[model samples]
Target: MLRRKQHRFQHNREAHNVIERGKELYTTIKGHWQEYFKNDNPLVLELACGKGEYTVGLAENRPDVNLIGVDIKGDRIARGSKRCIEKGLTNAAFLRTSIQYMDEFFEEGSVDEIWLIHPDPQPRDKEEKRRLTNPHFLTEYKKYLKPGGLFILKTDSPFLYEYTLEKLKEFDGYEILDHTNDLYQSPLLKDHFGIETHYEKLWVDKGYTINYIKCRVQ
Candidate 1:
């Protein structure tokens, strides 16, 4: 398994859809996504995108938008990169980097939307600062997200759902567009809700409610 993982990482390095750390493109691609994607389509990012289920799904469903999946794990990114290549998804790409360094890759106000799908809850009180919706990370996201851009979060952890809500309230310039503790039962369900990540499926099968939030950054 270890060998296969290494092989996938290597394959991702060679794949056109992937930009791994230490590569020249990793740094040069910053603020030049239009050139990389060869289009001026609105850009969307999926952070901590393990396996990139949503990234691939969105690209397949929304051809008018360009999608990039960001994650630190190259082996995991390989799966989504391969799928995009197989399907000839030119508008989809993968970036292997930690979410903390997002600003380094994207220009200020360049992103149309940011998605956090089933992110780590960081349930421990001491780890609250590490949550994706924490004020710290939200500040980072604000750097790249365009004014009035969307920030969406979908998670199975009640702790994360409530924590994110509180953070959004405390943070200025964020308007909550919609939220639901149980998405499947909510009237706010949209077409995109049909795309389920691997983790989402697992939690749903176990009778866990899926929490969703859609907010716009000012």
Candidate 2:
């Protein structure tokens, strides 16, 4: 309870910048939208989006896309919201909610692609089902991802990379477009996920390699 109150206080402090990212009121999305100067529009979802650095960076660099950064911590979203509004990022948003409950918000076939960046990689022997690669969550994501939509999983942990690799193999429809242990060694990583995460930067600084995959459900 104490922790919750602290988080709420921090979130309230930055309430002015964060537009509650939930879609429960999408009927008013366009109404409140700050018309971006860009002409093209594509929607992107970033699961487990902590500070939303990736979401905001991508939105700033690519004004042609709309980026939704999802994280459960209202306090963390507050920090991200400050950066977005300060940058005048018209194409980015931050949501305060659990990723497991995401399907309730995004409409079916509405999302263009996804960026699964540095997820917790839940590893409790009995909690394997909670991992993002769990089949149940995959099914939920399928409802939102458009046909041929891309999925990018970027991680510094070999365990998560290999685990997700096996998970994708289990899905007959998924086609692995590209994957590698050290994406910096390959040319495709730049084409897929774009920039790195805060943890990813630390990993690279510590000489840790990045393993990632870009795929699609056929």
RMSD of each: 1.1, 3.8
- Score candidate 2 by TM-score against the native: 0.83
| Top-TM-score structure, candidate number | 1
> What lDDT, from 0 to 1, does candidate 2 have?
0.75
User: 66-176, model 1: which lDDT tens digit per residue?
Assistant: 999999998899999999999999999999999988878888999999999999999999998778889989888887899999999998999999999998999998899
Candidate 2 stretches greater than 4 Å from native: 1-40, 192-194
Q: Tell me the deviation in Å of residue 126 in model 2.
A: 1.6
TM-scores for the candidates = 0.97, 0.83
Q: Write the per-residue lDDT of candidate 2 for residues 1-218, one digit (tens) a residue.
A: 78866875566454543545543343344323334224346678888888887888788777778888888887677667778887887778776768876655566777788888888878767878888877777777776788898888888878889988998888766788989999888886666456776778888989888888888867
> How close to the true structure is residue 117 of candidate 2, measured as C-alpha lDDT?
83
Off by over 4 Å in 1: 191-193
Error of 1 at 117 (Å): 0.1
For candidate 1, what is the total of clashing residue pairs?
Answer: 0
lDDT of 1 at 215: 94
